[model samples]
Target chain A: MLEIFARLATLVVHDLIGLEAGTGLGDAAHFFVEDTLKILFLLAVLIYLIALVRASLNVERVRAFLAGKAQILGYLLGSTFGAVTPFCSCSSVPLFIGFASARIPVGVTMAFLITSPMINEVAVVLLWGLLGWELTLIYIAVGFLVGMLGGAFLDAIRAERYLQPFLAQAYQQGSAAAAGGGEAQRLTLRQRHDFARKEVGEIFGRVWKWVLIGVALGAALHGFVPDGWIEENLGAGHWWQVPAAVLVGIPLYTNITGVVPVMESLILKGLPIGTTLAFCMSTVAASFPEFVLLKQVMLWRLLAILFALLLVAFTLSGWLLNLVEPWLTTGAGAGG
Target chain B: MREIKVLGSGCAKCNNTAERIEAKASELGVEARVTKETSPEALMQYGVMSTPAVVVDGQLVHSGSMPEPGQIQEWLQ
Candidate 1:
């Protein structure tokens, strides 16, 4: 269905615009049009549907649900909710304080926080659209694993001791009362439509530029890079490349919406899947700005620890995925 | 006079929420005092996990999104 649109666009560009097929500019133009249309269409539809389902879910209710749950179950549910929940980064501080004061385990809260950015609906939809299902499933599984294990490890080390002074005091006092946000009431169809429409507008407004920028970058690579150049230079999947890709991604900040398209082009160009995944994940999740935001809640030591933890997780997963690349890609190559 | 506090991390949306409330109050000829509360402590006190949450005279009334003009008019009244 979507390929038909790409083909139609290519026809229009080539026939009407007098651009020759197979030329760099022609291919780049076709790529930009096709990907931009596909991404925007998918994002709007998926976001609206997800928002309708999410109308009843909120951070307060999630806090109420996770509080006092069993340890392992708490982490699992926390990470699960993080994946499904629609969270804004601006609310992180308040959410952190609320969770901490409610006496939810620090690790569980960390699980939620870590998974929130890594496995959002936007990320899932984009990955599925750009990469094939096998890779998407693996990415989701890795995201959940990282969150769960990271949380458990933090708990084992008693990481709550590293909270900022005021947060520690709040935790000790347990000043938070019931975490509930009133009982859920069934919404009328009209209410759901309004909410979903607003959500589509808000989210689309925020991410459309990212989609364009990402697809444009992907188009540039698809157009200009010489064939077999990447394979000859970097396709060996050397173990050291994973860590280097991770380190390179640390300083650059972008969202998953902006990185998935780039990932598509990299894999198509013969870069190792694991190295590309590591670079993209690092770009999305591990960044200076996000850590700076967390500094409001966590002490410097804890922040550093979190940073190192993410780097290690991304590197390890990259390596593991690279080791299994042969089996993973036997039948499935990166899809458009 | 009513006191309206917009609680958030001082993001653009938070500022816009504060401005909207202030504009609505004056437009409705309702005497109101508005403030932007960026403190996490204030957010905790109100049990708000999202922002820009609205606190009218110490009572949290709405949260997690931008306020509509109609909602602001209702708040003022």
Candidate 2:
């Protein structure tokens, strides 16, 4: 009995501090705990900042303006504007909520939401710098067209009816406040500065967790996933691979900046350009997290439409790449 | 003091709105304090739902799209 008690106590102490007394399990457990804790702490700080920003938004005036715009024009403008923005996935959600609360036509808002992550100046510059002018121009034109058309399609569906009851009510309240032209409150310079700080914090807070999760997932895949399998299975001549890659990508999200390096590495490792591009598009344009965030503002029906549009767009882009792969490689490879 | 807030998540449209507002303020020589608001909370408080929203004197003047520089200047006046 005395010997057993001593062994148990030793085991407990070892496990508690990840020392593994006499075994190697303690070291592995310690490493895992340390890495995970670090990630968790970083994510916590990031989310706190995002939440601070989100809490500070003024939704009423935005709702009033949305009520005034032409739905189609709004969608077109939203999509076009989304393409020019420099926002990452997390920052885009607050913007999405603002549109929804503002009562901007759902379809148009969807258009902006979709295009914002897909097309951007950074992505464009990177694509051009890494790929070439031809591919870059094509991506921009296609991305913009898809956003415009997708928004119009969603608008035609009258997708706004799907908002959660609570969000809808909040939107109404905001509109009402705007209509009353409530007493204008002015903020002093110091107040505005404070407001800005809080806002950045709030926005960052809400999104940091998602960003970390995404980064961790990406990092894990980067570290452990076998590129040869993806290359062999999804490479050219496989018609189904295009759609499959896009479908796989929709659930995954990452910024173009993070994805570009991985993509470059994959391409170098014999991964099909089309497969890699499809993956990139899916990660950015149709991310699951983006959908989850958009759900806060949009109804299910509109979200579905947005998803379908992205699916088709990304699939087509992948397929088209396969078609032109031979020519592009021949022309571009010589320079490389 | 006049307060102007540009709301968007540091995207191109948001930046454009900010630039336009600055240009408008400069052109009119309006004594308004111009600031960029990228927080979801601040944007929601103003009822702005789109990227690149322009709020003048705590009133949301534009949302969902970037207003032209000329139009922004007009709004400033």
Quote the lDDT for A239 in model 2: 87
Q: Can you list the residue pairs that collide in candidate 1?
A: none
> Highest DockQ: which candidate?
1
Encode model 1's per-residue lDDT on A41-137: one tens digit a residue: 8899999998888887778888888888999999999899989987666667888998999998899998998888789988998788778788899
Whole-model alpha-carbon lDDT for candidate 1 = 0.85
lDDT of each: 0.85, 0.60
Docking quality class, candidate 1: medium
lDDT tens digits by residue: candidate 2, B1-77: 46888887677667867777777777788876789876566766765544677887878787755677777766777
DockQ of each: 0.78, 0.19
Cα RMSD (angstroms) for every candidate in the order listed: 1.6, 15.4
Best by TM-score: 1
Off by over 4 Å in 1: A330-333
